[model samples]
Target: MSTEATQPYQRIVQDVRQKIRSGLFTAGAKLPSTRELAETYAVAPGTVQRALTELRTAGLIYSHQGLGSFVTDTASETVGGRTDDWMPDAVRTLQQQVRDLTARIERIEKGGD
Candidate 1:
């Protein structure tokens, strides 16, 4: 996939991290599987795994052999230097959201008599 396509993976990772920190994922909550994640973002499983690996390396997620990955209790504190990893993804996601909302409103207007 092109760089543009992979950008959402980073954004997804960042969004997940936020959820964990906010207790949305909670400690030991089983996150969506790589396949589910890929389906949700229309990306390859490899891309999801790559993004998960970043969370794992940052100590924000833990994976069991046969089970699944989960958010850790102390993930926020441990992510430390990796905090800024989400900036580009967030910015891009924000930009896309604005564009999507704008387009939807435009389409609604265009249907008017």
Candidate 2:
């Protein structure tokens, strides 16, 4: 077996992905900040940002401007998974309501009842 070195940012992406898949960082769990992740992984913050970008593009995590990143449901992107204990019930409820309303509106617009 050849020992090949993966790119630093890709390594971050893989590790985080594995963690999420293994349920260590289950859906809606807040990921560590870029700075913290950089320190933990001993990589530059920019590298962490790149990994985060990849995750975001893949729909694995979502971020709010000041709130930071949280994992999304990898199994079904349309429905949000369970959130962290610290996440407010109202926020989760509101998110679900929005999704439901949007889906209803879409169906209506398509004349699909």
Candidate 3:
């Protein structure tokens, strides 16, 4: 997928992963609904779903059919492994931030904001 297309979902994934690692989102804590997340992130619900899928695949979260997603009990342990292992994810997060900022700047320059 193109970086522009992937950036929104990756941004969600990185934010949630950081919350998990920081213990801000404790085990069993419910996540916001997909619609809520979409609104908050200013992306489509499908984008939020894509982000959730990544988190689930990473073992950081799980969902119930009728219920909302929740942080996995092992979320912190899964994300807080060796310090060296965090470099790639950290780099991706920084890159995402830069992209987001660039987009905002372009919008502002065009008087879209």
Candidate 4:
């Protein structure tokens, strides 16, 4: 399915994040230009720009104005004293998953399976 039809900016942010997290976009490496990502993903450059903005806010990447955005080194100091946005979401998701699993196990033990 063409998931890009909904939430284009979110999809762009996710694609870039996945690439960085997967090591496809490396630390200190420049990301695809807004024009390039927009063309490749078949979306407007504004959408790509919004995605880049989100990444910058999350501290996973930064821009150089004359240059392009680059993946920030994990150990490097963050821009604007921020932490990556994905980190908190992942931690919460894991916590919720653990709780769900415990509840499921309790149900199974109680013969609710």
Candidate 5:
């Protein structure tokens, strides 16, 4: 699919992803309804639905038929049926932060401060 066709949905995905990572949307938090999200983002409901689907696919969130979507607790959820080495965006960002912190600690230990 063309990138342009998916841009709106991708924007929503990034927004929701950042919120989840920053703890603005806590685990099991009910996501704003798709209609609400669409209005907020000024996109069509279908675009918001697509964004939610992407988040679900990445294991960042989930949805029940009658209930709305919710943030997934990475500690408890096995995302996308893979357990060992799947690194989604939020996890990757966290991993990078850890690596940076470790480097900083090493430098301090070496008196590189």
Candidate 6:
């Protein structure tokens, strides 16, 4: 997959993760709505959702049914911790590769490739 093709959601994930790690987005901070994030990043809502889903999976954030997503209380701990609780580098790398491949496949299916 081209780097450009995989950039949008991944960029959002990286930026949000950085903010969490830097304490710019403190624990329990409410993230913007999906629509707001989409507008901020100039991407589709689905892309923002994908980035938020990755953050949630990494234990950095959580979402309520209607209240919207917020940084998890343990988010800073998770970001700073290097324990078994945190995902290993290998796992993260593989996950990125999987996302790239999935995007490539989707583009091909849509005849965008």
Question: Would you list the C-alpha lDDT of every candidate in the order shown?
Answer: 0.68, 0.69, 0.77, 0.69, 0.71, 0.76
Candidate 1 on 1-113: residue-level lDDT in tens?
Answer: 34466486696787787787666887668899888999988889988988887776555776655567777655665444345455576563454345435544664799932
Runs of candidate 2 exceeding 4 Å displacement: 1-4, 75-113
Per-residue lDDT tens digits for candidate 4, residues 10-74, read 88877776776666877778888889999988889998999887776666676666567777665
Candidate 6, 38-68: lDDT as tens digits: 9999999999999987886676777665667
- Which one wins on TM-score? 6
lDDT of 5 by residue, 1-113 (tens): 45466599998887786686666888768899988999999999999998987776666766656667877666134432445355677775564445445645765899975
TM per prediction: 0.61, 0.63, 0.67, 0.62, 0.62, 0.67
Worst 10 residues of 2 by lDDT: 75-84
Highest lDDT against the true fold, candidate:
3
* Model 3 per-residue lDDT tens digits across residues 1-113: 35466589998998898898888899879899999999999999999999998786666777665667888666787789833344576564554445445645765899976
Distance (Å) between predicted and true CA of 94, model 3? 31
Alpha-carbon runs more than 4 Å astray in model 5: 1-6, 75-113
Cα lDDT of model 2 by residue, 1-113, tens digit: 22157888888877887787667887668899988999998999999989987676555676655567777655133223542436576665555445445645765899966
Clashes of 2: 0
Which residue pairs clash within candidate 6?
A: none
Q: List the residue pairs that clash in candidate 2.
A: none
Enumerate residue pairs that collide in model 1: none
Clashes of each: 0, 0, 0, 0, 0, 0
Root-mean-square deviation of each candidate, in angstroms?
16.8, 12.5, 16.5, 17.1, 14.0, 12.9
Better of 4 and 6 by lDDT: 6
